[model samples]
Target: MVATKGGDRVSGMIVETEAYRGPEDRASHAYGGRRTRRTETMYGIGGTAYVYFVYGMYYQFNVVTAVPEVPHAVLIRALQPVEGVELMRACRPGRPDVSLANGPGKLCTALAIDRSLDRADLLGDRVWIERGDRPVSAASIARGSRIGIAYAGEWARKPWRFWLKGNPFVSRRDGMPRHVRAGRKAGGGA
Candidate 1:
């Protein structure tokens, strides 16, 4: 959930995520221990937000998952609306509910996330993950290659992307295993 400066709260179910292991992962900004002004936040303790701008547009939101200096982060790829749907709609006019936060960039737009939120603590009131009513089962979690990182060579093929099986909100469905696509589970459930 995210509470804006205006006091409107927006929340979602994290339907998709992609892990970027640091140092050895070529696709990671912190690969080879390289650090810069933009990547400083990633070195913080776990639960820190590593928000960054990409492609001259779009701010991508990531959760720093590693201990200090390790730099591992998970990119929040898609979310299913859980609260403040109307506010999200206004932020992303013309999009249907399902499309509102189906990608990293769109997720940021719908949730009003940006570089301004960089290094924010996920445990803070401004942004925090809530426990959903129903827990997702491990059997229903599907893994695949990270998207849009073909430049990472062999590292791009890592099965780091994880999403609920058969979730429409997942950014890309084509690479999912055939068995997962054929499963009976659907959105918001395992």
Candidate 2:
């Protein structure tokens, strides 16, 4: 959940995520320890928001994971609206409810996420994640490659993307048949 610029709260259940391992993952902004003004937040402690602008158009939201300096983060890909649905609709007018937060950019727009919230403490009042009302079983999660990183070479094929199986709100299908198994942890927000 996150508070908007107007102080209204918008919340959703995360249904899709993509993990980016630092230094090693070619798709990661922190790859090869390339620290800059924008990617510095990825080096922060876990639970920090590493929001960034991409393609000069959209702001993508990520949750820093692991201990400090790890630079591991999870990109929030899709969300299932749980609160402030009407307000979300107002922010993204004319879109169907299922499409409101079905992608990273759309999720950020629906929740009013932007660079201003970069490095924000997710555990703080402005933004925070909560346990979903119901548990998601391992068998219900599909694992596949991250999207829109074809230039990452071999790293583009890594099965770092996870989403709820058969969920209508998922932004796009990854075309993988594998499912997460019990006891296997999906790093950075499974």
Against the reference, the lDDT scores of all candidates come to: 0.87, 0.88
Clashes of each: 0, 0
Off by over 4 Å in 1: 1-5, 174-190
Worst 10 residues of 1 by lDDT: 174-183
Provide TM-scores for the models: 0.89, 0.89
lDDT per residue (tens digit) for residues 1-190 in model 2:
5555467778888999999999899999999999999999999999899999988889899999989988999999999898889999988999999999999999999988889889999878888898888888999999998889999999999999999998888887555333546678656343
lDDT for each residue of candidate 1 in 63-89, tens digit (9 for 90 to 100): 999899898999999998878889999
- Model 2 — which ten-residue stretch has the worst lDDT? 173-182
lDDT of 2 at 169: 82
